[model samples]
Target: MDKIVLLPDLAKQDNFYQENYLLFLRRKLRAAKIPCQLYLINENTSDNESFVAINNLTDTYYLFDQILGINTLSNPLFLADLKIPTDLIPNFQDSRTDSVTFWQGEQRVLTVKLNKFGWVRQVVSYQSDCFIQDNYDVRGFKITTEYFDKYTSQVLKKEWFNNYGELIMTQQNSSIVIAANQRKRFRQATYNSELEIVKEFLLQHVDDKTLFIADTDPDTINLRLTLPEQFRFCFLITDSATVPVGQNIGRFHNIKYAFRTVSLRDDFLQIAPEVKQEDCQLITPVIEKANLSLSNKLVAKIIYWHTGEILPALIKDYLNQLLTIMSEQKDVELVIDATEVLQAVILQQLNLLIKDAGEKTKPAPINTPAVVNRVSCQTLAFQEEKKLMRQARIYLDTGTKSNFTLQLEALQAGIPQFARQSNGLITPEVNGDLVADNGALPEQLSLFLRSLDKWNNSVIENTRIIEQMKPSQVVEQWRELL
Candidate 1:
């Protein structure tokens, strides 16, 4: 059956709720190892605007513009009032099990923490007997049959026992911090396709670990409140991602992992392709098929950087710069000095940039204490590290600076991650992944590169951009001009 998705009651009233909800839904599902994606179906309509989410039951995809709505498409109320689609009728919603039946009694609002791991729902007004399915019926996006039968059995379902159903699993005790833009340069995005692909990709990659994200309120925040039970997490690191409405459903649902603290990995960043950060992973598949002129590799770097732990405003800007350069300059890498010292140089330059940011304003990275310990103490056998180095020898494509920096930093800093060298050498073991037996680490590493600019424009524009960007608009705006 196709799952239905909904904006949180508070988010329905607030336009700003989207971003936080996005991060919220992402972290919980990923942490629980549940196969899910936050589908943002932004529709360009004649009257106002709207974005709807549908769950993917299959491998099929759809464009957002094709969805139908009467009022300003952005309003969930307008959507709810509309007739249910005939095609969606067979989605298998059992009114008896799906909705809580209310007896003839005064309704009371209850704030129930649904998913034990960490999923929670904000106050919902209903009779005690009435069952309220968390936003599943409305905002959820479902892929067509092609999507379901194709990815279901193998990609998402196969891991059912390990990822989605684990009572508790061993975490690598290490972390991968990424930097990515909040937005992309592509004129149009195929909503369902991007979300599900990345969801599957992450499930196939990454080890057991909790995910903490920095975001805004409304859309992203309500996501926590709307998640169904069995979908919760150990912790949630949030900023804001909500959508406010005049009706004022309730306070934004906020939850922090009990013993978890946001740790500062670096005041800096990197990427994991589809394998690293969820932020870039979110847009990765969509960006891949788009006809944008940008080198898929370079944009991957931007996606990587955009997945970082710094200020998202910066990440957003850097992504724009990346796209601008990629669109105009047929070439992204202008050969500079090549040496093993390249990684060290890149790290030094990035540190210098963060130092400069301190001169102007007090900076704060996510304070994850446990994460700091893990980042400070990860290990690998000499043979394993050597094997990864050998694989690294095969996949590196460009930028001696970025490649060396990502891998060397992981090793030097004691992170489990690895990198590809400038020679197109892959060193997959250096990658810290168990999934990529075939592809190089570049695609994933590049995702980390753009983080500097994507998360904190002030720092990137003031420092890193001067070094990494080409001589063009790549140095410019979208709240990330660096």
Candidate 2:
């Protein structure tokens, strides 16, 4: 049987699967024994064309925005042919679980509760069309969809309520709507090589104090540089390889730029903020107090002790205290000592609290290589190794393995040795060049290190393992280069 699929409009400001309604539908389909593949649309392209192509592969394909009636395919069935069971249809009453209460300082402004089903109900009541406006308000509640769209904008529809618990008005043309509508024109500027067109576009529409680019496409980077000096631009660097060339060329434009590196595999986003000497001093006490003698894992546990107990405000206060200490003492050693002391103290406290909690915690798990047995090795060459290493440059028994060794040596010399993973098992079946310079190796290696760092940080942040250990554990773990 051909597979069933659900394709999301990646260009859609919000992820389609993130919607509770779609999630509900997915569960229902799975329960009905329907195999569904989720295709994430990444490129900025025609949605209808993409869906049609995807539909050609699957027996049945459901477009995420099918409910919006936006698909312009020649096949009408593609738009409204989902055979979802009637019983599986969302019941607003049952799904009404969200509650929101708005407050004006000490005074309660309004309160509302609703769900995706409830929003759908309101949409249906207003119009018979299945396509729901991005935002609509029902009763005293406002409903909105959150997603990063092609314009890299977040749009919302809000409903206002009076203090008397009555619906005041539903604002359809909100700021988000204006921003969303303007994105198309702004995007056009990216394609125009003329600097004046791009400059004019920024002058008219780039009003935000900070602009965040979800992906670092070349066009987006071009537009980013057009912004006046007053605005701050924060770009989400997905991969070092994808970083636009000449990023530093526009440095003279007086733009303030910040970067937040994201690792999709590890699910980590780290803000790369410019740190000052004073800021370093502020964090010194926390590090100094931390017990450096303990294993890195143990230290991590102590730092994250009681995990959720550390409130954002408390962390802020700790940072403020560090800053205060730095301002008081100009001595760099004092600042370093303070950081070490603070680190030790925080870890020690966590250790004590965790011990009292009566729960055993273990170190975070690391990736391990498969064991190589003599028998397994004999048959390794016979296995379907060809299918596994298609992208890898395979090297046959060419002269001395010394050439491959030299390539590895070159890779290590250029890239950090700690960044690459060592392949423990040597299989005679796989005869491919391990290192292939497809003109992207350097960029890929940089990305690998970044992703490795992100993965390590995530593990440390979430687990109690060698929490006490230094941040350099990631380097040590991947020390063996392949």
Candidate 3:
């Protein structure tokens, strides 16, 4: 097995060279059906985990160099000792070395050197003549200096290079003209477009079982929410400034709906008041209150900013609504940044309110206890019922137990399982008596029961003559039920 380790040259000044070179190399390698495993080195990579894993699986290593600082080879033990004549060595004043060298035992097979500013200055190889001849079909492109010169000169100006020694520029076509700044802008736009396409492709094909680690960079943060919902979990390490509140709210919406668990950074709460207000408004309907938490520190900060005055009515209403939803959803976790001191202060305030209420209600003992208003209670109940109905529908859609399977079979048979009730009787009349018996159950549950009963009867009737039935007849009957 062979391994191809691709490390981007982050120091490259030209974005075109940095982005396209790897793409071109990878494509050519893949087209040739080379048995190579490619790995990308990112800023977050702290150890040699990828290298060690690849080396364990393969004997040969091919490092794809883009003339970046080749500091990736930190271990000198991996390098081969090859003595080159001093005359062959390129001379430099105040020399600072940066290069990737490949070795097999004591033989130095290849060496690619770059200067301090990350420009390719030299390439040295000591391999046999047969080595170049055997790989000429793949390596022949390196000898075509004119091809690269022609292509690069069109997009890049010679003046862009820091030090031009022996470099020669091809004559620019005078007919078509482009300003320097315009060319730079065009290159940036093209780079961004290509990056987006690659990101989209990776998102579409990402394996569900693997872990995807993304940095808090603006580009990565923007791409995070586009991932598939089926991912088991997602952990994001982000800065408050990189992702705006509007974008955060949108991404949170996806996380709340798609992912089972999400760990948001503490800095996520550090947002502008206006942004916070907008976020609360947008997220209130979609997320349960139990899954939302307003940090007390954040609340106190806001209050302090407002000179300790009470919050605006809109914000107060949003908090109240959130509390109501949270009260109903006990399983969902909402960790607030409330300190022990704040909790104690809240408790003391509540005690004072209770004491005051008790003094006023002493004359009317019968009406002493607080009672919720009927309309508010009804509204809460309605919301709870709606949530339950939604859950029941989801369960019916995805459940796979025997009972659910039977219900699905009945549904396919054109039997209306989710029929409405009229005067305590199941309407559309298939197994009305059975449905009535299960009246204590929820509507969807009752429907499933009735549908299951119908399916059981069909199964029984079909099974009696199952042995006598032809294969086609059995399939037809099953298909009808399905």
Candidate 4:
């Protein structure tokens, strides 16, 4: 649907905030091509009218942007134009149900609450657009599109590719817009050698090969969304791969694709129209099983988590939220003595992340497959869960204490201390955003771990210390490779 989305900043904390909510929303929108008006709300969520008149309701994407630390008001443009006018500032109060507060002669307050930002709420009726977690699906043709026809190359929009044989598309627009209005220049530095190579490859191996060439590496994840909430894009595609039915994915650039082996020969023509609609419907019915296995939510979550690095701050935040959601479940214990399992996992894989990254001296980092496949992420996650389960069982055996503090004590007593230790050193690639790399400890959550310097070496540490240590070890190993 071609529409604008009005997203309000939804967070409550004691410190700084960010536009992560907005970034999360924009990523989903960009991937889905669900265009909408972006009303970036400040402390103004309680206009009530914003949530009111919620007509043409498609879906309201609510992104929870806490976990990773980011400054929400860091933009200079917003600092210049936005203001805190005292007159518009609202006075808030707790909305008690059946409160006898009158506005006029007939109006009696039914349901309304004063939120943290001093905003007023009245007649709260909300309609949410489908809430998608995030977009990690980068699947689609990434053409050398910026240049020649954008199907095969990264060319400037206008300066001149006239000498480069086939000009599929020239400028950004089809019309003759004046130079002042135009934002992109038509210029691609192709002398036909690039195309010559591709054509040769297609002709030689058309029947049996797959060529995966990307202008940019696809391994690194993009997580700069804590600020700007919208994605501006230019795109094209060359081939169409079927997106499973009932799934929502975002847009792409350079979408046009080429068929490797289709020709205008009589043999090809003989098979072209052979398959009838009757045959198509017969196979369509069987695709439901495959469609159910493809999950949009999983695609989004994995993308966001993997983008930052081995231990993304977004993931810890996500896990915390998951725990909150699952808090009522009596069986699922959130805390685990992460040390022993983590140490086992890291020790199991350290030979790969640390030893191999520096072993080879190519100017750019090469993909160390041995390190990458050391342990499947699923295994680590399950190990942590199993440890938590084992401890929770011990706690349950003692009459399943209901007190929160007592439960924490039970958890601490059960927390396993990791046996392996090292004066930690990590690779820079641990956090993906190369500059944010810190060799100290490792994972984003590692900062909250046991301090070896603080311990006298003889004192027993809390069980959570072990939880904090081993993940850091794995993180450090990855950092070493980075």
Candidate 5:
């Protein structure tokens, strides 16, 4: 079987709670029966077992820091073994198992944070709410510890360690104070940055059989140019932001690029005119095809606002438009898709708007339809968002920035999406609508709500759009590139 190594951007410790984009690509490739392996370039606190448990990755991944004989310990690092000061006792302030605090009678002294693997992540000592020392660990092994200035509470000194508990590196006042024998007893080479270290490791370890698929991060882009020409490389371009500027990709031998959409490829070509059209292929990650089934009654009109910055004024403007639509259409309801913080603000604004509108108009009689709060908040989780999209009469794109993920999700859910202007994700009358003016948005949405046949036609059109990016079609595209 052929091996394909995926070089994604640095993995964060909080990746377990967030949407891991790299994990999506890895799963899609594996689903196609491709032998895929993930390679990390950063020092994540989670060990192999803990990382795989959360990420659902198999036994085919490598971490550069771990492979370099740093933070290689698999055992749990107990806080008791460190022997905390006798004066300070454990204080169970919070119910969280991953965090703990130690108090010296009435004064808070020390705090310790742990990973899900029960490994001590950081030990911080505080004097009168000012940090004195901060010791950080990776995978149950101490890696770096920083001492702060007592009076200023600024980082004064930092000590770096190896797997063997050796203080091989230290820094003071933003400069290396004591550093030597960094690669002692393991590999002979010593590097300045982690990127250089990973680049060297790849050159030394990967064979000709290894097909490298790297995200278009700056380090990986540099690696693409610096690596030996004989090595085969393919870049996964997810959007226009990742496209390299002013570089002739066609000049590189045994190198190709895979884009998720034609709009992205067109954007890339505008910048890198020298890039050959043949060197790039449109290959979307697996998008689960949704059946075009309309709801018997349209109750919700979803507006996804996850990708861009959350502005209350903008959200208020969108809600005002929705409120207008709701006033005329009784069955339609507003469902906002945003984070928890944004949700609170949106709900507050919507309530205020509804209240103001009620105050302006005369009180309704008892016999009329009881006043109903039509505005509600929704989540952007996969299944929940898919459900909301399918049940929605129309998806309103209200954010300033274009959200490619939500666009794909709406298409996969067989929903009609309304955007301000047609971009790479939206085609005027095909997959979604383009209502440039806010005044026209309510009118367009109201039209769709009144005409079930028109809405069903839009949903059917979504199937045609999604057919080009289905899992089977994407797998075949990958097969051709590989």
Candidate 6:
């Protein structure tokens, strides 16, 4: 049987590897009982087992560092094994920078940084003369250890080690020496780029039966050009913004097809007429169906926002409109679905706007005795956001770039969506509205808010629209593609 191999751009901490199509493909393949392997190219030091645990991926996986010689090391290294000189066993601190400090009595002895996976990323030991930092892999073994001059606080040299604590590589200045063992034969090699090392490793694995589906990144592009022309490969197009259409077609003889969503496929073909339509396969994502039956109907309305890198001016307008709408009718809230950092920034800007607007705008009289703010907004994580989307009356997408995933989520949730730009999901006055002019948002939004019948009709239409991109249908498409 021909096994599908998923190659991601990179598998670093907080890179949203969870949301990548490579894992998505693996998951679908797993459900269908088809053989698939996630081949990681990048050097990931974090505890990737956390990622594997979260995704239920315990079977076939190939890590770049583990493949070389660490495969035989039975005992995995953990933070506990390091046994940093500390009075108390310290808990991993909730840190945005992914670091924590430890003290041995008065002297600060050690500092440990964690990856987003909450595993020990790097451990730095403070000595009287110098500080040494150790970088570990997911296997809980040190990959690299660097010595720094305590006086200058500059790196002296880095020693790379295999999982069994064998010195395999070293780096000083611009020089790097790799000690590779093939068939129990040891040899030292100097390479200009790590891609050379990767090519050598991949050469041992590449066969006629294996299918490599990789992200269309620069690294993969370079790899495709470097590799033998006989190997079959596919470019998984996640976003069209990054991928150039006409360039890759005849550049490599082995690139069999490009996999993308229906909308992305059309967009790709439209941009580059030189590229054939059949070259890009339509493989829509598997979006889980929201169980609306068990969901509670919101007493207050919600405006879900998935616009990435939100401008303060754009948000202020939405807040002003939301506040005005709230003053007239108190049952409304704005939910900005974004990262924690972005959420904080948006809230800080909105607070200033609310303070200024609150002075001028009078609070609307309601039946409740207690006073309430006219402007109401909050942010939720993706999991909570998923639940919130079930009760969302309207979804606002006014960013310059179209967020296809969020658009699909809104479509699945049966929310009346509005977008600055249009995609296959957005149908003006049918399932959702298109915001051609930002100035007309107030009137258009007000019309939708006033008409309950129109809102319900759109929700019904959204149900019909989302049928084409169901998970089962998408998995079937994958079965066909594979």
TM-score list, all predictions: 0.18, 0.23, 0.23, 0.18, 0.71, 0.75
How far off is residue 288 in model 2, in Å? 27
Candidate 2 residue lDDT tens string, 383-468: 12222112111111111112222222212112121111122111111211222223332232223222435323322332232233
Give one digit per residue, the lDDT tens place, for model 3 in 31-113: 55533333332221112222222332242222211111122332212112224443343333224456665555556565555
Ranking by lDDT: 6, 5, 3, 2, 1, 4
Q: Order of all candidates by TM-score, from best down to worst?
A: 6, 5, 2, 3, 4, 1
Highest TM-score: which candidate?
A: 6
In model 3, the runs with Cα more than 4 Å from the true position are 1-89, 93-192, 207-213, 225-233, 238-252, 256-264, 272-482
lDDT of 1 by residue, 1-482 (tens): 12212222223321112233433344444444444433342222111212223323232122231222111112122223333333332222224323222222333332222222122211122333342222211221211111112222222111001111221111111311111221142222322333333333333322234232323234334433344333322222221222122112222222222111011101111111121122111110000111111222233221122022323343333333333333332323211112334434433434544564556453333112221111111133334433333222112223212333233222322222322121121224332332222343334434323333321222222132223322222212101200
| Candidate 5 per-residue C-alpha lDDT over 1-482 given as tens digits, one digit per residue, 9 for 90 to 100 | 56788777643221212344555666777887776788765544443333534342453445545443563546657667677878878976454657788987887777887666666767878755357554444446666677776687677766666666777656565444334455553353444444555566666667877888877777777777777788888887776567654264546778788876676787777877777888888765455656543553544444443424547777666666666666766666666777777777776765655565567563422112222365667556656765666666667766554555566666666666776534445666555677554566677676667776776777777777666767678667778988
| Pairs of residues at least 3 apart in sequence or in different chains that clash in candidate 5 | none
Each model's C-alpha lDDT? Answer: 0.26, 0.27, 0.28, 0.24, 0.63, 0.64
Q: What is candidate 6's local distance difference test score?
A: 0.64
In model 4, the number of clashes is 49
For model 4, what is the alpha-carbon lDDT of residue 301? 12
The true-versus-predicted C-alpha distance at residue 98 of model 3, in Å, is 3.3
Choose 1 or 3, whichever is better by TM-score.
Answer: 3
Indicate whether candidate 1 or candidate 2 has the larger TM-score: 2
**Where does model 1 exceed 4 Å of error?**
1-34, 43-66, 69-218, 222-409, 412-482
- Candidate 6: pairs in clash: none
Please give the range of 10 consecutive residues that has the lowest summed lDDT in model 1: 281-290
Q: How does model 5 score by TM-score?
A: 0.71
